[model samples]
Target: MVQTVQSADGTTIAYEQAGSGAPLVIVGGALNNRQSAAALVPPLAGDFTVITYDRRGRGDSTDTPPYAVDREIEDLRALADAAGGPVHLYGHSSGAILCLEAAAAGVSVRKIAVYEPPYFTHHVRDEPWEVFANKVKTLADTGHGDQAVEAFMRHAGVRFDERVKQEPWWPAVVALAPTLHYDLTLEADGVVPEERFGSITAPVLALYGDASPDWAVASAAAVATSVKDGHQGVIPGHGHDVPPEALVPFLIGFFHE
Candidate 1:
């Protein structure tokens, strides 16, 4: 069933739930909404009451102007409250950063599993962020949001096949271009916020793909080291976009324990 929760700031966060077990909330990264969790839901549903949501501004969720990291954190807290209390969290890419931040803030969460959060060790953010953001802002503001999406994808090393460009879902991506800038702003040079990660006392499972970039490995490693009871693992034969199956077993094991 679809459910809605009012975040502390009054933004309405929409979510869906399925299967039956301990509550597990899945948060997707940049340019993603609830639909992005489709691939993971089936396999995970057997073991968890999976709750997938449209993080504000992405899908059915409403957004408040002047975004702030703490606001997103509050949205998560509201979701957890709706789930009947503390729940496990699973976040991919930039969404993983949000999950870690929530846990660090001592929010009511049981455990967390984050996959390849775009945390850079040295200097992964190649260009000065404002330049990149300005380019995207210009394209999105100029009524060429699709091109803006394309630009952001290219910047992220995404090589889209012609067939992918032809897909119906492509337009949805274009429509969400502005949120890409919001995400990049949240990323902020991809550096790990050491103070936050280190402050987290809840158990964390930091997942990195074998084929992921060096910076991803460093970031996950740093997170695992910081959390009091955190663990790290590598998903073999995967890149930055590790498939859901590679994550299922580890997640089931961690949350069940």
Candidate 2:
């Protein structure tokens, strides 16, 4: 079933709920909404009441900006409240960052599973991200949404030409060019402090792919080291993008326990 929750900031956050056990909230990466994690949801719904949401400005969610990371956190809080409080949470990429911040802010998160959050340290610098953001911004300014989506694919390490054509969500990514800048801004400046991580009371499962960027691995390691009850897993063949089969089992084990 689909519903709307009003965030503290008054934005209407749209969410879909399926299944019937412990509630689990799934947060998707940039340019993704409830549909991005479709492959994992059915299996997950069998074990838990999976709550999938369109983060602000995407899918069916409403967007009212002066975008701030805290506002995004509030959206998650509202969803958790609707789920009857303190639900298990999972986030991929930028969504992981949001999960971390929400837990830190004392949200009633039961457990968290983070998949390859791009928390760059000195070990990895995001040169391509800045360039890509600027190029996309230029394209959007010039009203070239198509070209902007192409640039986003390159920045995300996804090949634009053949694969984008084959993927169903490629056009949706292009349509959301205006909000992509908000994601970049958050990535560049809104990292959670390492010291604050220790205060998160929720059990955390940090997953990284062995083939992921050095920085993402480093970030996962750092998060595991800092959180008191955190565990780390390295998926052998995957990178930042996790296969649904791999992710569902990990999440079910952690959350349903």
Candidate 3:
């Protein structure tokens, strides 16, 4: 059954947990809800009490106006508290950036792992950050959620094909378009904050798929070196959307270490 926790600002955050062991919270990336991590849960369930939650402004969770990255950190802190102690936190894409920020902000997490955070040590995209940011923000704030989603996907190298549009989850993804702004906010210029991350004493594992672009690999490496206790891993033949089979082994090994 899904449960609820009140964030520091009183927005209700919805979540569910399974299995029986140390708490392991899985944070979804942009356009994702709790269901995004559904496939990883059962395999990890045997060793951990896997927890997945809808971030504020998406799915079963409710949002407060005036989104702030710190508020998102508080949401994770609330989940960590609800788990009764520190947790093993895992995040993907923009969610990975949030995880690092939370750890740096002193959330009680035993360790953190991230897959393919979009940060780049060397800027890759030709579009100026301000131009891209404003374009997406205007589109989302003007009630053109579908357009905002399209813009984000296109910029991220995701193809906007008819097959993708026909998927049952496409509407759900578009409905989450506004949260794309929040994800961009978390990324903040798409560079790793070395000084900010230095504050995180917890172990961090930054993983990238072998098949991903060189920029992603470089970013992941930068992230690993930024934290006090950080490591990097490569999952063979995977990309941003890493399969559970390729990902679970890394989580099991890292969290256990």
What is the C-alpha local distance difference test score of each model? 0.85, 0.81, 0.92
Cα lDDT tens digits, model 3, 137-202, are: 889889998889888988888877757777888888888988898988887788899999999999
Better of 1 and 2 by TM-score: 1
Per-residue lDDT over 145-239 for candidate 1, one digit per residue giving the tens place of the 0 to 100 score: 88788878777778856677689888888888878867776677677777767878889999998887787789889889878888998889999
TM-score, cand. 1 vs. native: 0.93
For model 1, the local distance difference test gives: 0.85
In terms of TM-score, how similar is model 2 to the real structure?
0.89
Which candidate gets the maximum TM-score versus the true structure?
A: 3
Ranking by TM-score: 3, 1, 2
Model 2 segments more than 4 A misplaced:
123-138, 162-169, 189-192
Per-candidate RMSD, Å: 1.7, 2.5, 1.1
RMSD (Cα, Å) of model 1: 1.7
User: How badly does each model clash, as a count of residue pairs?
Assistant: 0, 1, 0
TM-score of each: 0.93, 0.89, 0.97
What 10-residue stretch in candidate 3 is worst by lDDT? Answer: 120-129
Error of 2 at 191 (Å): 6.0
